[model samples]
Target: MNQSFELTPNRLRELRGFAIAARLLNFSRAAHEAGCTPSVLSRRIAALEEAVGGKLFLRTTRRVTLTPRGEQLLAHCERLDAVMLAMAAELRPQGGEPAGRLCVHLPGAYGRLCVAPVLARFLAGHPQIRIEAVYDDAYVDLVAGRIDLALRVGRLADSQLVARQVGSMRRYLCAAPSYLAAAPALHDPAELKAHRCVAFSGLRTGTLWQFSQGRRRRSVRIDPVLSCNDSMATREALLAGVGIGIQGDYMADPLVAAGQLARVLPEWELSTSPIQLVWLPGADRAPALRALIDFLSSEL
Candidate 1:
């Protein structure tokens, strides 16, 4: 007869490995955290599954996923981790600045033009906090992407994430003054078809440019001579007098003021979007995250 299963010290270590693996959903990452090899983690997890009599994870080539049993176990593991952290904090000195890794998601141009500068100042103050900024305009799954914060511009769909209005964003049709000088005058929005343009590759394949003034909205289909995914690259093309570019207010203003770029349609009002700082609902309480929010709210 097999001996009755027991929750020994070794079993507790195995559970901890399972928790880390489930949180990251990657065996290698979990193994790194445990300071061991992936093969070691695999054997321990196999043993744990045999002892618990249930499959805790489904390992695939692309990713390691949690099974239904794993999900339940993960929740319990998280609660335990929270309790242990709280207990440990109480015993240790409550000194020093908030210290941890913060992985943030940001739009390319906004990250480079706006948020990156702020983070430079922010990191100087919180030297203990480590930051990783991933720039993209596409949607990111906070949980799966391991993102602690995200800055987005525009209306947010109703979701589980909590958001705060941090600033504002406005688009403008702009071009180099030299380009405007040599090219035919563009008096109306419809005239963009006759002009060369710099387009963003991120735009939907068949998407058309839409503009508005007062209550009237117009859409135009224009061919782009240069298409790019990076905002900075597009701005550089615009500076070289390549074509008209749709740029955010923050990006266009300085160039316009410096005589490098000029607004194409001063009479038209481009749609504005709200800039929001989004995160998990419970993330506000994190000392590092809270410090960043306060800094941005005041600065932005």
Candidate 2:
């Protein structure tokens, strides 16, 4: 035969009683406010104290005050209550917009030119969502850093993250007219070997330059005295007549347009890298993320 058992409402009732007692500070007043007798309220508070194995309140003849632990617990309970209320508000669904913090990571140049404008437009549309944008060239660990999404360029390394191809980008070999005039005339890919090469040197092979013409592809190795990891620094060095450097159109576009830098080897098939927006699978599909991606796709 199964024995009959009833679940206890002791804990929740006790907490309710404690909440009242803490607010009112007087047992009689708390009892009246909680719709229970003073004796019942006292017993409930005692049971709550016993169940938690800690005295939550210090009582005097005239007043009742919370202990340090009780204060901390009260603060936490207040926060929990606030969150519950917010959740309820969200559940109401009165044509409300998505509102929360959005964190994004992007490569440096693209962040400034491409992502920044998209972000600006997104922010304009959804004034509720707060944005935190981080720009860097180094590959950031999205999972470890809790990044909502990343705008990654070029060939992606093997990873578990899902990616959406937003657009394409190409690198170009360019030099200032002054430098091209002062330096030896580069007529062919073979002549690049004789010219001073300003290398970004992030890759393993520093001097190796790849070029293609129709079906013919050639890689020429040269010596570069100036090498740096920072792309902006490399661009500046190229501008300062350090040497001819190959960089992406994102960086080279303004300079090329201004005639500060001229695109070389237009006939040669140059290496091109794709611009992709990447995010982890099973991550929060926030409206902010969707809005950002849509804005970028439309703009870029």
Candidate 3:
């Protein structure tokens, strides 16, 4: 007769750690999400390995890969996670106040300039919920990162995640009043090549600036005097008369109104990027996640 396996509290905790580690494939990140240290997470995985009578992950100094056994275990863990989520949904009271820890991913500059302000109000209204906001310009895999929600700005590719367009942002070619006053007369996009440019590394077209007027489309390659991955840093450089660069209307409009910055080629238009809220599609949406989505949709 085959022996029956039991999942005790400790075993379940270990398995949960294993599942998170498997998804991330990075012990440090898994440890962070699991609310434990890397050493503790490693010990849990080691304990799990002993219980299963096999090594699950092949760990190197730089990377971690799943063994065949680990892959099989991960498949089981996924199913278990789905079951648990569904069960929680069923057990939760209908129309219950949302309360839990919600992890949110946000773009660095937009999050600070736009989203960060409204968060305090959201928290004030929902006192039971705690938020962990990770701000970065780089795209992250939601599932791998175990993120509950993310706000992205730009054209989105088709993916398995569910997305809702919250708003749109207009891009403008802009520079400080100081830079524009002394620099070359820039009546056209072509003139940008002759001027010192501060390039934003996060732009989809890299250093190529695109503009359209009437029926004419222009693309100009700029050799930047300075390049920055962070939009806020780029804005700071532009404000200090470093060079001309693209700035989101939200960031530049106020400065322009204050006479600190001037718009370049106001006649031409740059394409607008949509702001979206994205989350993994699942059978059960936690009430906290739902509440946050609705709140941001209105606030943003």
Best by TM-score: 3
- For residues 9-71, what per-residue lDDT tens digits would candidate 3 score against the true structure? 677778888999999999988876665678888998998888888899998888899999999
The TM-score-based order of candidates, best leading, equals 3, 1, 2
Candidate 1 structure quality by residue, lDDT tens digits, 85-147 = 787566443584777789989998888888899999999998888999998978788878988
- lDDT, residue 259, candidate 3: 88
Query: Where does the lowest 10-residue lDDT sum fall in candidate 1?
Result: 200-209
TM-score of each: 0.68, 0.65, 0.70
Highest lDDT model number: 3
- Model 1 regions more than 4 Å off: 1-93, 203-207
Clashing pairs for predicted structure model 1, backbone only: none
Supply the global lDDT for candidate 2: 0.75
After the best TM-score superposition of candidate 2, give how far the Cα of residue 279 lies from its true spot, in angstroms.
0.3
Q: What is the lDDT of residue 290 in candidate 2?
A: 68
1-300: candidate 2 lDDT, tens digit per residue: 013312154555566667767766788887766656788778877776665567889988877899876676567556755775687566633566766787899877668877898788788988788989998887888878889888887777734555778889888798888788888877788888788888876543457888888899888887886887767878988888877888888889999999999887778767877888877642434555666766777787
Question: Residue-pair clashes per candidate, as listed?
Answer: 0, 0, 0
Q: Itemize residue pairs with steric clashes in candidate 2.
A: none
How does each model score on lDDT? Answer: 0.81, 0.75, 0.87
Query: Total backbone clashes of model 2?
Result: 0
Candidate 3, residue 177: CA error in Å? Answer: 1.2
Pitting candidate 1 against candidate 3, the one with the higher TM-score is 3
119 in model 3: Cα distance from truth in Å? 1.5
